[model samples]
Target: MNLSTEVRRLRDMDWGELDIKESGGWPFLLQLICCVLVLGLTLAGTYWYLAAPKLEELGQARTEEARLIRDYQSKAAQAAHLEVMREEMAILEERMNTLRDMLPTGAEVPSLIDNISEAAISNQLSIEFIRLRSPVSQEFYVEQPFDIRVRGGYHRIAEFLANVASLPRIVTQHDLTLEPMEDAGGEQLQLSMLARTYSYRQSGEEEEAP
Candidate 1:
């Protein structure tokens, strides 16, 4: 049919006379328009049902991929500097050991006393007394004090102090008093001092009741 005839037929079509069960008996124009409408609705419904979920899944997958990339970069950076971290740990351990070695044990106290006496004798000083006092307890270590009395010339006493200060173990001298011996005609000088050394306590030693 011509375009104008088809348009006129569509415009003048009667809907009430058409039989619902006899679609094939309908006019050609009416049937063609119904088929086009059904096809368009079917295509739109199919796209919404099948393609929407896949688009959401693609978006989630992209987000997960970005998170994994960030994790890999962080781990790679740590691995790159692993050797430097190990070297720093070794240096810290060495320094800790050196400090531990400087602390003496209980058994070594007598030897330390002997060393002090020897230092005094080496400097030509008279060691009158070297007595260990009661130990003072501290948080991490025990302070072992000593009462030292010596008689010598000024230069000899100075040398003895320097030698004691240079010992390997940690020792501190304080409360020093010097007086000339009147009976020795100002030739001999008396020196009195307090010396303290430290020893490490075992981990649970301080917590125990005496």
Candidate 2:
């Protein structure tokens, strides 16, 4: 039909006479609009029933894949550095063993005391006394203290300290006192001090002299 005739029929159509039974007589414009509405509703319902759920599942799968990739990369980096970590641990253990050797053993303590005595004599200091004090128990070791009294020139006392520091075993001096002897014309000095050494506390190790 001509466009003008269809336009006039749509405008003059009787709304009350429109019915499903007479749909063939309906205006072309109205039929076209009804067909477009039905098609749009069908497409919308199809997407809701089928495509929507699939799209949602696809999004969740992408997120899980990303998480798994990140986890794998982190574990791979740790595996790559595994050898370096082992070497570092070995170095740490070797250094620990060397430090343990620096601590004196029970049998060696007598020799260590004798060495200190020799150091005093070699520095021209007269030893008044060098006696062991009570040992202190610690978590990892024992503290062996000695009360040392001597008479010597000032420089000799200093030299004795230098010798103690250079000993193969570790010894430290604390609480030093120097007083001038009454009749030595200020040339002779009396020295009193606390000397400390350590013995490692290991199972089945002999206890050093108390």
lDDT of 1 by residue, 53-135 (tens): 88889999999999999999998998999999899999999997897788789899999999999999999999889999988
What TM-score do all the candidates reach, one by one? Answer: 0.57, 0.59
| Candidate 2: segments with Cα more than 4 A from true spot | 1-79, 203-210
Winning candidate number (lDDT): 2
What C-alpha lDDT do the candidate models reach, one value each?
A: 0.89, 0.90
How many backbone collisions does model 2 have?
0
Worst 10 residues of 2 by lDDT: 201-210
Clashing pairs in model 2? none
Query: By how many angstroms RMSD does model 2 differ from the true structure?
Result: 7.0
CA RMSD per model (angstroms): 8.6, 7.0
Model 1 scores a C-alpha lDDT of 0.89
Q: Which TM-score value belongs to model 1?
A: 0.57
